[model samples]
Target: MEPSSATVAAYSPCGSTAAVCRAVAEGTGLAWDERDLARGTRPEPVDPGTLVVLGAPVAGGAVPALGLERLGRVHTAFSPCVLVCAYGDRDPGHGLHDLEAIAPGLGLVPVAAVLAPVRHVMVPALGAGRPTADDLAAYRSFGAAVASALRDAGGLFDLAPPPLPPASCPRERLELGFTAECDPAACVGCGACAGACPAGCIPADEPYLTDTARCDGCMACIGVCPVRARSLSDPARLAAVRERCVAGWEGPHRPRLVMGA
Candidate 1:
């Protein structure tokens, strides 16, 4: 069941997950297109024969609600698909499990699942300098393997869902109250943060002001600020989160790839 082509869809606020998606697409040896869900654009309908690569960054212990919502809109018909979750050195928790559980409803069959380590948007110190050159290479290798499996399958019906990793973090970690704040002096009134905000919480008129109520704490605004003006509002809170992350996952971690039997 070789696919005609491949499409990579992702909701990466800080682009780490998107980078992994691209690497995997490159491995498939098929023509690939991308749909950035972070920008709030709707992805076009995918043909049944097209291979789909879907991914989102892990926020807390699971995928962000908005990422899941946008991905749910992409209806398919049992199309062969690969699932990916990019995490910030902390426990990937049930992110992959959650994505796999919903794959069927999205008209997708999970042929493979990947958990890639990337810098945490909220706490950069946790998984700093990640999705390194080695990480991308591994994603490409995994993609190639996925392509091989599809090429060997008799048809879509023969494809089986891969076994995903068990849940690691507790559900309590799902809601970490974090918000991006901007420094007035360093902020040059650039609209980059507002434009890059997936939640659209940052106002254009007052770019430095983040509507905390609406912000999902993705930290895209902090990443996009040219002057590095934006950051998590509370240093003590961030430190505590970082401490927990370090205590749980201190050593360097690599991407985890699971393929179908």
Candidate 2:
């Protein structure tokens, strides 16, 4: 059955995944209902006839558990849905695969999956200024293709799930354990970083300090710091990721799209 509208949900702290998800939604040629999980809002119930687009940034060689947890809040029954995972140049990992694995249990019928490449939060130089004009255009095209597939299918079950992207980088090598460190002196007491943190590790009372144990190291706090006070606490881990970025993801990489059959 053809969908009436689309709901786009993404847990993007640094904004890359959100940007990509928006572009894809625009390409679907449907009115969009947006849910930015960064705001700590619960996902609304998905209409059975509404197409759903869910996405998250890859962290620690996979999609962060928080992202998956937020997705679980969405209730749907046989709704056609698209899954996406944005990763730094290192590896796509099992993010897309894992999302697909949970789709059935969530009452979602997986229709397509996208593995997008974006600027690395930890190593900005890697995939820097990425998801360029060309990449976004490609993503839009992928979305249109998904729309076309839905239009032609008889029902959600008639369309086959998109093929999963193959994992490249070894999981062991992708674990760069570094939490954001805020410089107390440079902090101006603005709570932008605290609000931007998807992991909710930043306390509102003391925005400058992050709970490292719960921090996903998504770089959201660092990105939102107006004074540029936040930084990765582990220099050694930073260096290691930088080295890997240069060796593995130096040049431009196109997003991988698997359109539903």
Clashes of each: 0, 1
Residues 158-208, model 1: lDDT tens digits: 866788888887754467787888889899997999999988889998997
Tens digits of lDDT, candidate 2, 1-261: 778899887878889998888888889999988888766667568787688888888887777777778777777888888898898865677788767877787778888988889998877876888789988999888889999999998877888778776765554435566778899999998999888887888888899888999887788888878899888887876788678768775456778888756
Error of 1 at 184 (Å): 2.4
Whole-model lDDT, model 1: 0.85
**lDDT of candidate 2 at residue 247, scale 0 to 100:** 71
Candidate lDDT (C-alpha), each: 0.85, 0.82
Off by over 4 Å in 1: 171-173
With a 3 Å backbone cut-off (N, CA, C), the pairs that clash in candidate 1 are none
For each candidate, give its TM-score against the true structure: 0.94, 0.93
Model 2 pairs in collision: 1-155
